[model samples]
Every structure is written in C-alpha cells, then in structure tokens.
Target: MMYNATQKVISLSGGREIVIETGKLAKQADGSVVVKQGDTMLLATVVAAKEAKPDCDFMPLQVDYKEKYAACGRYPGGFLKREARPNDSEILVARLIDRALRLLFPADYHAEVYVTVNLISADKDIQPDALAGLAASAALAVSDIPFGGPISEVRVARIDGQFVINPTFSQMEHVDLDLIVAGTLDNIMMVEGEMKEVSEEVMLEAIKFAHEEIKKQCAAQVELSKELGKDVKRTYCHETNDEELRQLVIRETYDKAYAIARGASSKHERMDAFDALEAEFASRYTEEELVEKLPLIKKYFHDDVLKKAMRNMILDEGIRLDGRKTDEIRPIWCEVGYLPAAHGSAIFTRGETQSLTTVTLGTKLDEKQIDEVLVQGSEQFVLHYNFPPFSTGEAKAARGLSRREIGHGNLAWRALKPMVPVGEENPYAVRVVSDILESNGSSSMATVCAGTLALMDSGLKMKKPVSGIAMGLISDSATGKYAILSDILGDEDHLGDMDFKVAGTRDGITATQMDIKVDGLSYEVLAKALEQAKRGRMHIMDKITETIAEPRADFRPFVPRIVQMVIPSEFIGAVIGPGGKVIQEIQKATGTTITITEADNKGYVDIFSQDKDGLDAAYARIKGIVAIPEVGEIYKGKIKSIVSFGAFVEILPGKDALLHISEIDHRRFETMEQTGLKEGQEIEVKLIGVDPKTNKLKLSRKALIPKPQKA
Candidate 1:
C-alpha cells in the first residue's frame, strides 16, 4: 500500500517533543492520527454517521480508549488471551478525552460519532493517558467533522517543590501534586488529580503551567489541520429552530420557572414544580398544534428558559435553588460500626446523600492484580463505589457499573490512599466498598467521608481522617459577580458554571476535580472557591471525628488473624518444594493460608487463619524450616527410616539427621530393632556434631541420656 505520511513536532517546556503523524494508519476511517511522545504512541480514529439518528435530541458520541498488550510486548493475562471489557484506568482516560471533546462539537449535532484511541506502543517512562486527548483532537482536526477544538491534555506534577510537565513514571513517585489538565488554546476544560494537602495557590499555578504547554500543542494541531487542507468542516443542520415557538415558550414559562427555581427547597419539590410548569405550558397549545411543536416546546422550556432562570436566580438574586446561602453547607451526620458482621462499616449522611461504606482487611493473596499495556502491578488498597437507581429515587432497573461509578470510586480512592499505611507499617490488603443508599448530590464525596470512618472502625491505622465536599461556582462575566457555593445540590451542579470537588483532612486538600463550563474563570475565583470548599470540608471532618475520633485499637474479633514470618532464602525452596507440594501440605495440615514472596533475598511469608490453633500450627512449621541445627542442643524428633546401622531422625519440619548404631544409646545395640526405635516413632535426641563442609547434622540418643560417670 502506498503511504504518504506527514509529521509535525511541537516542543514542550520540559525539553520534550510531541510528534503528530497522519495519512499512514487506518485509512478507511473518517479521520486518523498517530501521536507520539518519546517512545509512547497512540493511534486515535473518529468516525461519524452521515446523518443524525431520528428523534435523537442528544449527541450520541462514544469515546473508547484501549491499551493493547502487544504495545508493551506482553500477552493478555485473561482466559481469552485478548482484550475484553474496558478496565477502570482505560475508562477514566476515555472519560477525560470525552469531556474535552464533547462540548467542542456543535451542540445541535446529534450524529453517532465514535472515537477510538489505542496505545499502539508504550514506554515505561512516559504516560500514555496524558497523550490520548491530544491524539483524539488531532484526529478530529484533520477530519471534516465540525469541532471547535484543538484541545490538549498534559500532566503536571509538583516534585521537590517544583512543577513538572509530563513527568516520567518514576518522577511521579516523589510528587506531592499530580494533576492532569485538559484545555484548548483559550481555556481549560477539565482538572483532576490528587495532592498532599497543597495550597490553592500552588494548584492554580500548576494549572497555569500546564496551560502554557497545552497552548503549544493546540497550535500544533491547528498547523496540522491547515497542512491537511481540512480547515473547512462538513456542514449539517441537525436542529430546525422555531424562533416564534421558542419566544412563546419563554414568555409563558419564564416567570413560573424562575419561581420554581427560587421557591422549592428540596430536590423532589423543585422537580415537581418544574414538571407542573412544563405541563401547564403544554396544555395551552391544542393537541394538533402540540404534535409538531411539542418537541420544540419541551426543548425550549427545559434547555433554554429553565436553564436561564436557574442560572439567573443564582447569579442575580444570590438565591440558590435550595434556598441556602452560597457558602452554607448542608447538615451532616456520621455513624460507625453500622454492620457488626463487617470488619469495618460506617454510614455517612449529608442532607439527602447517604453512603454505607465498609472496609475489609485481607492478606497479600487478596491484592488486586492489574495488567495494563504500560503498567503491570497489584493494588494493596482498593475502593469501589456503587450507585443504584434507587439511590436517587429512580424506578429504572439496575444494570451494571457505569463510567460515573468508576470515576467516582477512583476519586474517593485517591482521597483516602494517601492516608493509608504502606510497606511494613500495615501489611494487610485493604478493600473498601461504598454503596450510595441515597444520593442527591456528591455521593462520591460522601463515599470519601464514609470510607474514612470504615477504615477507622476496621482498625486500620490511617494517618488522618478525610472528608470531601462539592463546590459550585455561579458567575456572570458581564456583571462581574460570582458566587462560590459549598456543598452544592444536584440542581446546583447541573445549573452552575462549575462543578468543583475537593477532598482532604483538616490540614489541606488531598484530591480535587474541577470542571469549568464557562469562560473567564480566573485564579482569584478559583482561590475563593477553594477556600470555601476547605471550610466545608473541615466542617464535614468535624462530623466524622465526632462519630469516631481515631482508628479502633484492633480489628474486629471475627476478622481473620494473620502472622508474618521471615525465613532464610535457602529454605524457601524446601518450604515450597517441587511444584508447591510442601506449602500445599502445610496449608492442608494446619488449616491455614500461606503466601510466600522473596524480598531482599529473604522469604517473606504471611500466614492467615481464623482459629488460634491453625495460626500457631502454621507458625511453628514455618519457624522449624528456618531453624538452624546446633551441636549439643536437644530436640524432640520422629524417626523417618530405620536402617541396619540406626535410624534417621527428623528434627525440624523438613530437616533430618543421621543417628548411627554407636550413637543410638549408651548401651551397645547390635541392631536398630534392639533399641526399639522404629520408623514413625517419637524420640528425644541430642545434636552431637555437624559437618562444616556438608551441613550434615549428627544426632545421638546417648547424649540426651546422662553417661554413668565414664563407666
């Protein structure tokens, strides 16, 4: 096949260059581009239907990110030996790209657009996720689709008190601030990351630093777009707006909608009021007139009038839909040990949102193994969040996990991960599951709060308790008025300009996610919002502490008992035996679970059992295998094999020594049977000598019996 590939390189601030190439791969797709940074490469393709779906009122855009095992020169680890469903990391990257590009498309365009990004090549040093957005944008830019962007995504990490762009995987280890920022040339669209109680100024500065780099990338995409002669996009009319109908709907419903937004304090009441107003407007039109104009009327009222009224009430009147002050937080209450059967359980409620979270302590065997293209590891601590339809008073049937659930779970995980102990400080694997029982707004934040309580209740010694709050921003650029709302409701999050979430302890911010839908959101406004969020977070933290001030003294009595043991590196093979025969025997005999891994050239074994007898039996066997034989030391052993000379005595679990005829006893014995020591007989013996060269131990029964004064 003939290929004509054109490439452009854009240099970043950190001496890193991003190379974009097109006209080489996936030629049948509507648009395709390969983006490379260092050794990492991503191939992004976009395809859109020629016409919009009938009766579709929303953009049917699907974004998928896949990491191929071949990219990292590894085989897929599952039963199929191929890629299956999207993992959490891949889903998150897809969401990042989706959020950045979704709004850039024409709002009325409801065509089924599918964007797929694949990591064709991976580098251990470079992160592929940060480059996915850029690749997707470059693909769209070179295509005929009508998109308003050329957006770019960059990762900024604060390491050793300095901001770094696209830091290597190793460099991220020391970062106190790790943020991924996606933006266009003019404004930032998304911000998500975790921090170590960093100040608001530092976070803002990092974003600014990231924006400068994003601008350069965006410029590169523009140049590429022009080079490909794709500056003009395809034209389509997906919406036929009736100006008269829109005006009529606004005139009849504006005041009523405004009153609904301002009058109703609860979610259900507010929704009911809006629904009644819409129905009243529909009743005014004749049945024949509504058939053709009903869709238009509903659209105008819901998207135009209702949206405007809600935003204006907050911006102009400083009155939120919930009738609370801008900075006021909702009531909060927390309870721990809600479920005695669970290792740790807590229930956190804030206003209408409630999370029932539980924590479980496990051994290393329970660690979750991750096998991605660029990363292969295991997670010792995992957090999962589930939101059922019933949680929000919906009658829809529960399906499976959605992207929102994974994203929310990930956020809560980051908030609590920093406080979790690692290495030898805490050896048990931890798993936290948060079930959103009731949700109006920010159930994820409630999950964070509930997770902290559960961890403490489970007796996991966390560094500090964490609390999270969702903050909203209402801004009017023309009037220079903006409101920073703390503990925003679901309606506020939908109607406001920004939905910002901050999670932290009393000290500072730990994790944050900011999605800005409007322009001109300056650092000053962000600082104010962050400060207000901190106050809200601290208030929530106070409630959590009131419920459980610290981690419990010990784990629940029903939890399994685990003991760690270290054995000599040489003894590891003997303990494991050939094909795990020895360890299997040990577990079967002791009724315990044992996992051994070699660290620092020593075997680190963890023994887990429910009963004390099982734990003690396993511990004893492991200790015996590592024990060294000493001369003149007495031992209780069992006879393994009876020979003409004597018998072989098994001292330790796997250690055995020779007992010759002369050393059998003080009295002479012609045969081993005369001493009455048979195979499987229990006897006491003394270690008389050990061969230095062969490591052979010599055992004698006469040494244990006192010699009769040299007689």
Candidate 2:
C-alpha cells in the first residue's frame, strides 16, 4: 500500500531544522504526525470521538506522553521490566501539552479528545520533552477536530546572556533561565520555567524570543495542514440550547449573580448563594421541563452570567470577589515548629488557602534514584505536593498521585532547590512534603512559602527564603482596559484571563508559570504583572520572616546527625570488606548508618547516628581503616591468634600483622606456651616495618619498651 506523506521543515536558530511529516504512520487515527529533529523522533496521534457524551458540558481532553525504553536503548527498571505507569517527568510533559492545547479547542466542543505523543527514537543531546508539545499540536492541526490552533511549544534557554531556542540537553546545563513557551502564530498561551534569580525584564525577553521561534513552527504546521488538505475541520453539534431559555436565564440571573459578587462573601458562602439563586430559577420550571433544560440553565448561569458578573465587577469597580482592591493581597499568618516529631515543620496560611509542610533529612541512602529513559540520576533534594479533596470542600475519595501534584511539586522544588545547600555544605539528603489542608487558590505557591519555613525550621542553612504569589489579569480587549491583580483568589483564577505564579526571594524570581486564556497579551501587561507579583511576594515574605526570622540554630535533639570524612580510594574496598561484611559489622556494633561513595579518586564516607558516641565510634573505625601504616607508630592491637612462632594482631579494623614471639619480650622464650601471649588479647604494639615483597605490616611490642625496661 502507498501513503502520501506531507512534510514541513522548520529552520530554527543555529541551522537546526525540525521535520514534521504526516500521513505516514498511525493513519487509522483522526490525525497523526511524526516529528523528527536529529535522531529523536516522536509519533503523535490525536483521536476525537465523533459525538460528545450525554450531558458533557466541558471539553474532555486527555494528553499522554510516553518515552519508550527502546527509544534510548535501555530497559525499564524494577522487576516488571515494562512500563507500569507514567513517571513524573512524563506527566509533566503531558501537562505542558494539555495546558497549551486545551484552550484552543472550541469551548462548546465537548467530544472526548485524546492526544498521545510517544518517543520512538532518542538522541542523547536533544531533549524529547521540548519537542513533545510541537508533535501534539501538529497532529491536531492535520486532524478534522475543530481546533483554533496550529500552535507550537519551544524551550528558550539563556546562556551567557543570549537566548537559544530549543537548546540541547548539554546547553541547558549552563542556562541561567530555562522556559518552555507555547503559542499560536500570533499569541502566547502558556509559559513555565525556572530561573536563577533572574529579573522580570530578562524573563520577558526570553518569552518574546521563544514566541519568534514558535511562530515559525506554527506556520510550518499550517503549511503542512494545507498540503494535506486538512484545513477544514469536522462539524458536530455538541450542545443544544433554547435561545429563549438562555436569554431568560441570562436576564434573570445576571443581576442576581452581580449582586452576589458585590456582596463580598467567603468562598463557601458565595458558593451557596449562587447555588441558591440557580435553584430558585430552576424551581420556576416544571420537573419535566427541568429534565431537558436544567443542564443548559446551570451551564448558562455559571459560565455566562456568573463568570461575566465576577469578571466585570473586578474590571469596572476594581473590587475583587473577596472585597479587596485589585492589588490587595489576602491576609497571611504563619507558624513554625508545628510538628515536634518532624525534622522540620511549618504552617502557612494565606486567606482561605493553607499548607502544612514538613522537611525530612536523610543520608545518601535515602536519595531518590531516577531511572528514566533519557535521564538517570539521583536527587539529594526532593519535594512532594499533595492536594486532597477536602481542601476544596469536596466529598470524594483520594486517588493516587495526580499529574497536577507532580507538576506543582516540581515548581516548588525548583523554587527552593537553589537556596538549599549542596555537597559538603549539606551532607544530608533533604525531602520536603507539602500537604494542602485548605485551599482556595495558588496552593502550589503556598507550598513554596511553607517549604522555605519548614526547611529553615529543620535547621537547614538555606541561602535565602522564597515566597510565591499567584497573579491574575482582568482585561477588556474592546475597551483596552486591564488590571493586574496580586494574590488572586480561586474565582479570579478561573474567570480571569491569566494565572501567573511567581516564586522567589527578595532578590528576583526563581520560578514562574503563566497560562494566558485570552489573546493579544502585550509585553507591557506581562511586565506589569511581574512587578505586581514581586510586591505581593515581598508582602508574603514579610509575613514569613515575622514568624521565623531564619532557620533554627541547630537540628532538633531527635534528628540524626551526620559526620562526613574522606579516605583514600584504595582503602574503600577494605573499609567495605568483601560483600559489605565489615561495614555492616561496624554499623551494627556502633548503632550507626554509614555510606561510602568514591569520587575524584577519594572515598567520601558519611556516618549518621542520633547518639554522639555511636557517631564517634563509627568515625574512628573508618578513620583507622584508611589510616596509612607507619614504621614507628604505636597502636593498641587485638590479638586474633597465637601461633608457634608469632601472634597475629589486628592494629586496625581490617589490618592484621604478625607480632613475632621475640617482640613479645626482651627475654627469649622457648615456645609460645612459655610466653604469656594468648589469642583474643589486647596489647600495645609498634609498626616496626613493612615487607618489601608482600607489602605487609610487621608489628613489634618490644620496640615500644625502653632499653632499661628490657634489661
């Protein structure tokens, strides 16, 4: 069978080209495309159900990104040996695609849409995630699923003060700012990245730089769609609306919703009022009529009437739903040392949102090992975020970890990782867990705040404390009026045009994530939002510092202390013994945990214990094992066995030497039985010499005695 493949090539900076080909693979799907850059290839397919499910009011979009072990010529870890579930890295990539593509689908298009991007080939230098979003958008472009985009996503990295689009994995290592920006040909939609305390202007410059490349990629997708004759999309009726009933609902509910918005009630209180208003309107209709019209009524009342009223109230009156000014931040309160048993704990509350974060310190054994196809390493610092149903006042069972949790945790980790001490400065591995006790908006940002507090509370020597704030935008495109809100509420986040989160210290931004819902968002507006966010972050930072000025002076009494030392690389094997027997014995006898890793021709040993005596004992054992034997040094040796000619003495943990019977005393002895030497005895000995041929230690007890004592 022959297939017609339409290809479009986009030239990026540095003469790199991305080739996107469609109609060559997965032809049975609604749309499919293969995106190739260098040796990396991603097969992206999009499938949309022909009809929407009954009562489906929202766009049901699901995006899955998978990297095959075969792509990178590696096998999956663990006993199963096959992919079980999407890891955090894959989930984050999927989220990037979902956030960029979700808004482009028509609001009324409720059909189930699934976008799957699989990495079938891998390049060591090229990062596949930066290409995943482009593959997904290209697939959608060649499909008959009504999408308002041929958008593309690109990673913009700044190295040595210059912006590079779609930087290689190696180039990213030296980047001060790294961002993934997704956009259509004319408008930017989503932006997320971490930075090294970069200024707002620099961040804006990177975004603009990314958009230029996105425009090129998007144009290529458009050209590809035209070549494939897929510019026209399929038509479907996913919504049924009675024009009169919609008008009646709008007319009757608009004023009521506006009044509720102006009332400045709490989150739950406002929710109940709106629900009551909807019930009152639904009561006017008979039960039979409601069976058919109720869904539309609820949808219209919430989406059109209530959303518009809330947005307009903020835009026109400069009053938010919580009755605060456009730039006003919600109240904040914080506490540290909240959990006595934890290594560190803190509670940070901002308005209705609250986070209880705890920090745990561990040795290298507790470091998280990552074994993904493209990336493999261990992390000394980890952050996990949890959002429960009760946090939002919902009655639902808690499932396993969600993609949102991973994404949010990653952002917080990036925000605080820079402040964490590393290497010799921080010997213990750190894990931070943030659990949302209550939430209204920007819980992830709250996690950043609480994480800083908890880390400080745990006696971690953080470079600087980080605080985060979620900024919102309310704009009138027709009137050219807009407002940049600080510390946005949950309702503002849902109804507003933008949800921009900025986290950092007073120095600059460490991490940022922005999702723009509307089009034509100018750079000036973004700059304004960033500046407003800085102020809000400072306010939150003040609250945080007021509660706890800095990290505690020292770790809690129950926290285990780690003592680190270095030894010669050759001695590491002896210290560990054959099959770890020696190290295990030392740990068991001293009640300590010891970890040894060799780097730079040296073995770094970390001993952990809550008991000072145990720590000191383990340290001494390791020190003696690595200690070089000297010719004149004296040691308290333990006699292992008494032979006919000599006794075997262990001067160090594993260093055994022969103590000749002549060295036992100046007076000669005929036999070992005549000498008072016995096995399992402690005696003082001197390292007399080392055999040139065997490199063995020769010890003597008589050498330590004076001539007069011998006489």
Q: Which tens-of-lDDT digit does each residue in 162-213 have in candidate 1?
A: 8988889989879999999999898988999999988878888999999999
For candidate 2, the lDDT comes to: 0.92
Extract clashing residue pairs from model 2.
Answer: none
Name the runs in model 1 displaced over 4 angstroms: 13-15, 678-681
For candidate 1, what is the lDDT? 0.89
The list of candidate 2 runs beyond 4 A from truth reads: 708-711
Give the winner by lDDT: 2
RMSD in angstroms, all models?
A: 1.9, 1.5
lDDT of 2 by residue, 1-711 (tens): 598877888887788889999888999999999999999999999999999999999999999999999998999999999988999999999999999999999988999999999999999899998999999999998988999998999999999989998889888889999999999999999999999999999999999999998999998888888887789999899988888988999999999899999998999999999999999999998999889989999888988899889888887999889999988989999999989999999999999999999999999999999999989989999999999999999999999888889999999999998899978889999999999999998999999999999999999899999999999999999999898999988989998999999999889899999999999999988988988888889999999999988888999766899999988899999999999999999999999999998889989999999999999999999888888888989999999998899999999878899998888878788899998877888999999999999998888888877756434
**Residue 343 lDDT, candidate 2, scale 0-100:** 95
TM-score, predicted candidate 1 vs. hidden true structure: 0.96
